[model samples]
Target: MKYVVAWRERPTGSAAEYEAAQKRIREVLALWKMPASLTIHQFVARVGESGYAALETVEPADLQYLIAAFAPFSITVVPMMEVLDVAAGEPRGIEWRNGLPCTQP
Candidate 1:
């Protein structure tokens, strides 16, 4: 299973506090045993100071383990399935028209 894990940082906290939180999360993820293969990528910050990670893992149960470990902090995990047509390394056909968000007409 693939998951997108998002974490909202504490707005009024110091760097040490934030680092502690991040460290805890990392430890939890390392210890988590899941069925799915795992691939994690941190998201680029947008409107807020929050951060997120996209993970591909085999064990769906790891999601729960992550949530439990991050208790008291806000965490959201969503499972994802790859669209074969859009899988990485595959060619995107001309069916994608211009005027799309990242494309030029």
Candidate 2:
């Protein structure tokens, strides 16, 4: 299954705290290795304060490991389906739902 993973550092009380948290985050990054169970499609960061990634894996435990490994940051994991894949699904029984397009109709 595919997943969208994102993380952001929690708010810090002061500049010193921010620096300390960043130091810890960097340390974790340096020590961590990508899990073999996951396929990384993209890994990116924004302004050094947050990160985003697209990953696919058959093992759900990989996500649990990810959260534990990056404990310093707030993490969110979402299951995703490609838009085209969703659009290509059978349209049966969907016509009654308003605002939805049904190919069969």
Candidate 3:
């Protein structure tokens, strides 16, 4: 499965605090190694102190380690599905929902 991992640094009061947070995050990235279950496709940092990555992994649980490693920053893990997959499944999904025995007026 593919995933989009995003992160934003938590609010800091002063410049020194921001620097400390950055240093810690960098240290973690520098020391911690990627696990075998994950494949990083792309990584980029935006103008703000936020960044996101496009990653592919077989086991969803592998991402827990990543979130833990970046505990200093607010992080999110979102599963990605191809546009074609959503389009193909739309009809079946609608059919299944319509077939439900109960409906709301």
Mind giving the per-residue lDDT tens digits that candidate 1 earns over 1-105?
667887675443788877887687678767856444556755554574565777877766766776776674677787666787356524444435443477546
> Of the candidates numbered 2 and 3, which has the greater TM-score value?
3
Candidate 1, number of clashes: 8
Which one is best on lDDT?
3
Clashing pairs in 3: none
Estimate the overall C-alpha local distance difference test score of candidate 1.
0.65
Query: Best to worst by TM-score, what's the order?
Result: 3, 2, 1
Q: Which stretches of candidate 3 lie over 4 Å from their true place?
A: 100-105
TM-score of 3: 0.86
Best by the TM-score measure = 3
Clashing pairs in 2: none
Candidate 2 ranges beyond 4 A from true positions:
93-105
Q: Which ten residues in a row have the lowest lDDT in candidate 3?
A: 96-105
Summarize candidate 2's per-residue lDDT along 1-105 as a digit string, tens digits.
899999998899999998998899889889899789999899999985788999999999989999998888899999998888777763544544655665784
Residues forming the 10-long window of minimal summed lDDT in candidate 1: 89-98
Clashes of each: 8, 0, 0
After superposition, which runs of candidate 1 have C-alpha atoms over 4 Å from their true positions? 9-37, 43-48, 85-105
